[model samples]
Structures are given as C-alpha cells and as structure tokens.
Target: MIAVNGRDTEWREGLTIRIIMQENKYTSPRIVIKVNGHVVRQEQWESYAVQDGDDVLVLHLIAGG
Candidate 1:
C-alpha cells in the first residue's frame, strides 16, 4: 500500500502518478506532487510509476492574488 496525502491507499501494479490523480479526482490547474519526499515533475507524471510502501503527496494549489 501507499500513503497518499497522509492517508493509506491501495497500491496496484502498473500504477502511475496520472492514475493516482484520476482515482482521487485531483484536477487542479496548479498543484504539486511528491513521491518518497522527492518532487515529481508534471511532465513525468504520466510515466512516473508508484510502487508499494511509497509515500505520495498531492497538493492542490490555489492561485490568484
């Protein structure tokens, strides 16, 4: 299993960052994602694989000043 936003989530084989967002319905225009304490670039999300026992942090950004 993997930890997403501090909550335990099921870990599945062939899981990617893109899948995680879709599963959680995270579609914020601006956001950040961190895996295992390392930042995962937006361009790499589609191919970035998430493994079991991994810590994933998805933060939705609020923009407008």
Candidate 2:
C-alpha cells in the first residue's frame, strides 16, 4: 500500500509516477509530483518507480488573472 496525497492507495510492482497520475485521473497542466519529498522530473515520470509505503505528494499549481 502507498499514501498518495494523504490518501491510502493500493501498491503494485513496477508502478511509476506516470501510472499513478493516470490512476488518480490527475491531468492538471501545472501539476507537480514529489515522492518521499523529492521532486520527480517530467521526463523521468515514466521511469521513476514508486515503492511501497511511499508518501507521494501531488501539488496542483493554479493561476488567476
């Protein structure tokens, strides 16, 4: 199991940041993802693996006029 955005989620082998985004339906253009307090680069999202008991934080950046 893993903690995503303070919510418990099922853990799976070979799970990457990209997969997590898809699973949670996170499609914000300004979203930022960090695992264990380290930032995950956009290019590495597909390769950055998320392990069990990890704390994943997804921050959504917003702008207004």
Structural similarity to truth (TM-score) of each candidate = 0.93, 0.92
The backbone clash count of each candidate, in order, is 0, 0
Give me the displacement of residue 26 in model 1, in angstroms.
Answer: 0.4
Task: Give the range where candidate 1 is weakest over 10 consecutive residues by summed lDDT.
Answer: 56-65
Write model 1 residue lDDT over 4-52, tens digit each, in one string: 9899999989999999999899887598999999999999999999999
Per-model lDDT = 0.93, 0.92
| Segments of candidate 1 deviating more than 4 angstroms | none
TM-score of the candidate numbered 2?
0.92
TM-score, structure 1 vs. true: 0.93
